[model samples]
Target: MKDTGRFFTVGLVAAWYSSNIGVLLLNKYLLSSYGFKYPVFLTMCHMTACSLLSYIAIAWMKMVPMQTIRSRVQFFKISALSLIFCASVVSGNISLKYLPVSFNQAIGATTPFFTAVFAYLMTFKREAWLTYISLIPVVTGVIIASGGEPSFQLFGFIMCVGATAARALKSVLQGILLSSEGEKLNSMNLLLYMAPVAVIFLLPAALVMEENVVGITIALARDDIKIVWYLIFNSALSYFVNLTNFLVTKHTSALTLQVLGNAKGAVAVVVSILIFRNPVSVTGMLGYSLTVIGVVLYSEAKKRSK
Candidate 1:
C-alpha cells in the first residue's frame, strides 16, 4: 500500500509535466497553423472530455464524493474566473498562431510577474521588497530570453497580453473561491464544474469573434491525427496537473509547491525547444536564466513577507 501510494504520487508528477508541456506545444501548433479560434474550440472540447472522464472515474471507483462545489456566490465567482481564463486561453492560442513556440513561451515568462501584481493588488497591500524588485529581472529576462525579439504581431500580441491577465486573475480568483467548502471540494470536482462553465461561456465568444470554427470542424473531419492527439494530451495533462497541484500544495508548503511549478514551466520551455527543435539563441538563454533568478528572488521575498 505504501509503495502503491508512492508510485501514484510519482506518476502524478511525471504526468503533470507530460500533459502540461504537451498542451503548451500543441496549442502553439494549433494556433500557428489553424488559428486562435481553433485552440479555443479545442480547449472547450478538451474540457468537456475532462469533465466527463473525471465524473466517470469518480463513479467507477466509488470514491466518496471528492468535493463538489456549491454556493451561488462562490460558483458565480468561479464561473467568472473561468470566463477570464477562457479569454486568456483564446488570446494565448492566437498569439501562438502568429509567433514561434520559443518566442511564445519566452514571452509567457511574464505570468509570474502578473500573478505577483494581481495578488498584491487584490489582497496584500504590497509585495515584499525582493518580490517587487524581482519584477525587473523577470521582465528583463523575458526580453533577453527571446533574444530581444518582440512579439510584433499587433493583434496576436494584444491577445496574448489579455491571456496573461486572465491567467493572473484566474489564479487569484481560484484561491479565493476555493476557500469556501462545498459538498465536494477537491480539484477534480472543481475542474469538473469549471471546464463546462468555461466552455459554455466560450461558445458564444467563439461564435462571435472567430470564423475559424467551420475550418476546425472540417479539419477534424479530415482525420488529422496530429490534432486529435494534441487535444487529448492537452486536456488530459491539464486535468492531472490541476489535481496534482491542489493535492501537492495541501500536502507540502504552498510556496515550495509554487516554486517547483514555476521551475517546471521553465524546464518545459527547454523541453519544447529540444523536442520541437525550436530556435534557442544565446540571448534567449540569458533571458531564461534571469527569469529563474527573478522567480527565486521573488520566492525569497515572499517568504520573508509571510
Candidate 2:
C-alpha cells in the first residue's frame, strides 16, 4: 500500500509538473506578446477558474466539509493573504521581462531560505542565526550560475528578490492561518475566499500599471496568432498549479513536495535555454546548480526538523 501510494504520488507530480511546464511556456509566450497585461489577466483568470473548479468538484463529488467560511473575518483574512500571494506572481512575471529565466529561477530558489527566516521571525518571534548562513551557499551558487552577465539590470534584480520575499511571506502566513482556521475550511471554501481577494487586489494594479502598456505591446507582437491561444491556456495552467499543489500535498509529505518543486528552477532554466537558445555560460550553470543544491539542503533540514 505504501509503495502504491508513493508510485501514485510520483505519477501525480510528474503529470502536474508536465502540465504546469507546458502552461507556463505558453504563459510566457502570451505575456511576452501582451506584456504585463497577460500576466495580470491570467492571474485573475487562474484563481477564479481554479476556485470555481474546486467548488464544482466538491459539489459534484459530494465531498465532506464543503469548505465554506464561517465568518467575514475569516474570509477577509484569507483574501488579504491571497492578495500578497497574487502580488508575488505579478512581481515575478514583471521581473521576467528584465531577467533571464535562469536568473529569475535562481533568485527564486531563495524562497526556502526566506521562508525559514520569515517562519522563524513571524511564527516563533525568534530568529534563526543560520538563516543567513544557509543563504551564503545559494547566493554563491546563483552568482556562479548567472555567468556574470554584464547586461543584468539592478532594478529588475531588486524586483525579483522582492518577489521571492513576498512568496516566502505568503507561505508562512498561509501556514499560520491554515494551522489555526483553514483546517476546517474545505478546499472550495478556501478558494471562495482566496480568488476574490487576489482578483480584487489585482484590479487596481492592472489598471494603474499594465493597462496602457499591454495594448501597445500586443500590437507589436501581433505577428503571432498563437499568442492568443497561449494566453488562454496559460490562464488555465495557472489554475492547475493551485489544483495540483493541493492534491499533491495531501497525498505526499511536505518534504516530498519541496523536493520535487526544487526542480522547477532547474527545469525552467533548461527549457528556457533550449527554447530561446540563450548564451548560458558554464559558470552560470555551475552557479545555478549550487543555488538549487543549497535550496535542497535547506529543504532537507526543514524536513528533518519537522
Candidate 3:
C-alpha cells in the first residue's frame, strides 16, 4: 500500500509538471512562432475547453459531487473571479508573442510578491516580519533578471507583469469572496463554473479586439489542418494543467505544490531556452537564481510561521 501510494504521488507530480510546462510552451509556439496573434480568442478557446472538460469530469464521470451556485451573490462573485482569470490568461498569452519564454518565466517567479501585496491590501492580512522580508529577494531578483534580459520588450514586460499581478489578485480575491462555508466549492467545481463565465466574458472581447480573428483562424485551418489539431491539443492541455494542479494539491500539501511550482518554473526556463535557442546572459541567470532563492525563502518563512 505504501509503495502504491508513493507511485501515485509521483505520477501526479509528473502529470502536473508536464501539463503546466506543456501548456506554456504550446501557448508560446502558437502565439509567437506560429503567428496566431489572437490572445483573446485563444484564451476563449482555452476556457471553452476547460468548461466542457470540467463538466464532463464532474457531472458525467462523478469525479466529485456536482456543485451549483446557491444564490445570485455567489454567481456574481464567481463572475468577478472569471473576469480576473480572463485578464490574467489573455495578458499572459499576449506577452508570449513578444517575449521569450525564459524571460517570461523569470518574471512569473514574482507571483508570490504580488500575492502578498494583494492579500494585505484586500483582506488586511498580515504576515510575520520574516515572511515580509523574504519578498525582498523575490522582487530584487526579477529586477536583476529584467536588466540582464537580452530580448526585452517594454510592452511585453508590462503585459507579463500585469498578468502576474492579476493572477495574484485572483488568488487573494478567491479566498476573501469564498470564505463562507456555504459558498466554498472544490477546485474542479470552481473551474467548471469559472470556465464558462470566462468564456462568456471573453467572447465579446475577442470578437471586438481581434478583428477577423475567426476568419483568420478558419483560413489558417483551411491552409493547414495541423493548426487546428495544434489548437485542440493546446486547449486540451490547458484543462489538464488545471486538473493536474488540483490533483497534486489534493494528494499532497499546498506547500509541496508551491515547492514544485518553483522548481517547475526553473525547469521551464531551462527547457525553453534550449528549445527556442534564446540567448541568455550570465547576469540574467544570476537574477533568475536570486528570485528563485527568494521564493524558496518565502516558502520556508511561510511554513515556519504556520
Best by TM-score: 3
- Per-model CA lDDT versus the true structure: 0.70, 0.70, 0.94
- lDDT per residue for candidate 3 within 123-194, as digits (tens), equals 899999999999999999889989999998999999999999999999999999999999999989999999
- Which residue runs does candidate 2 get wrong by more than 4 Å? 1-7, 33-38, 61-65, 125-132, 181-189, 212-225
Residues 168-229, candidate 2: write the lDDT tens digits. 89878877777674354644456656776777787667667666655754764587766556
Candidate 3 matches the true fold with a TM-score of 0.99
Clashing pairs in 1: 31-97, 32-97, 67-184, 67-185, 68-184, 68-185, 145-284, 145-287
Q: Least lDDT summed over 10 consecutive residues: which range in candidate 3?
A: 249-258
lDDT of 1: 0.70
Q: Clashing pairs in model 2?
A: 67-186, 67-189, 141-287, 145-284, 145-287, 145-288
Task: Count clashes in each candidate, considering only residues at least 3 apart in sequence or on different chains.
Answer: 8, 6, 0
How many clashing residue pairs are found in candidate 1? 8
lDDT of 1 by residue, 1-306 (tens): 988877876666676667677777777766664443466676676667767766775667654365545568777876887788777777777787776666666567678788877888888857667678878897888766545544345576667667877888887877866664453366666676778888788777667666768576767757765656666667776666665666666655677676777777777777767766755677767787787787777777878888
Cα-based TM-score, every candidate: 0.83, 0.84, 0.99
Model 1 lDDT, residue 145, Cα: 59
Pairwise lDDT winner, candidates 1 and 3: 3
